[model samples]
Target: MKLLLLLLAPAIMFASERTVTMKVSGNCGSCKKRIVKAAEAVDGVKDAAWDKKTKVFTAVFDDGKTDSASIAAAIVKVGHDVEASKAPDAAYTKLPDCCQYRDRTHD
Candidate 1:
């Protein structure tokens, strides 16, 4: 019984469902695809979606391997606006002229 329970413990401890939402600014299907794809690209991200106009992004992933802020950062990496998160200089600089957030603070 002890051996059997020990084997099952790891699987039970590993079971988890992590989902979160974020704010991002945009206005088109192309933007949606880009933002969602960025978030989903992270390891352990099971899914991602966004409303381009509202900038709300939803993501489902495994918490043991990932977290919300990192996911949000990834979306910003591909040239989308995350509400309170800033994209890295290299990532932000790569944005299309129009996609750029135009905020000095983001630097």
Candidate 2:
């Protein structure tokens, strides 16, 4: 029981780590790679995944070290649009043709 308690203690203490999923506009495999890379670039982000069809990005991070807003900002910085944040015009314009998502959203 003592050994089990020791193992469980770490899990309990780190329970604040969480995963958040939100809409992120994108169109293809390249978008997925870019989105995930942007998300994981944020400090404390443990993992990130983006779904092209759903236009959703999911990220796991230690809440003690980072928050959803910070992660979203990182994605925006890399030219991806998150639900609450928009990528910069210059960065968005620099994306490859297949990665351009603004026109598709308008359509």
Show the lowest summed lDDT stretch of 10 residues, model 1: 98-107
Residue pairs clashing in model 1 are: 24-55
User: How displaced is residue 45 in candidate 2, in Å?
Assistant: 0.8
Model 2 ranges with Cα > 4 A deviation = 1-15, 105-107
TM-score of model 2 (CA atoms) = 0.81
| Residue 24 lDDT, candidate 2, scale 0-100 | 95
Give the total clashing residue pairs for model 1. 1
Pairs that collide in candidate 2 are: none
The weakest ten consecutive residues by lDDT in model 2 span 98-107
lDDT of 1 by residue, 1-107 (tens): 99999998987798687999878866566667778788889998998888655567899998877888889878877876688866677876776655555542121
Best by lDDT: 2
lDDT of each: 0.76, 0.88
TM-score of each: 0.73, 0.81
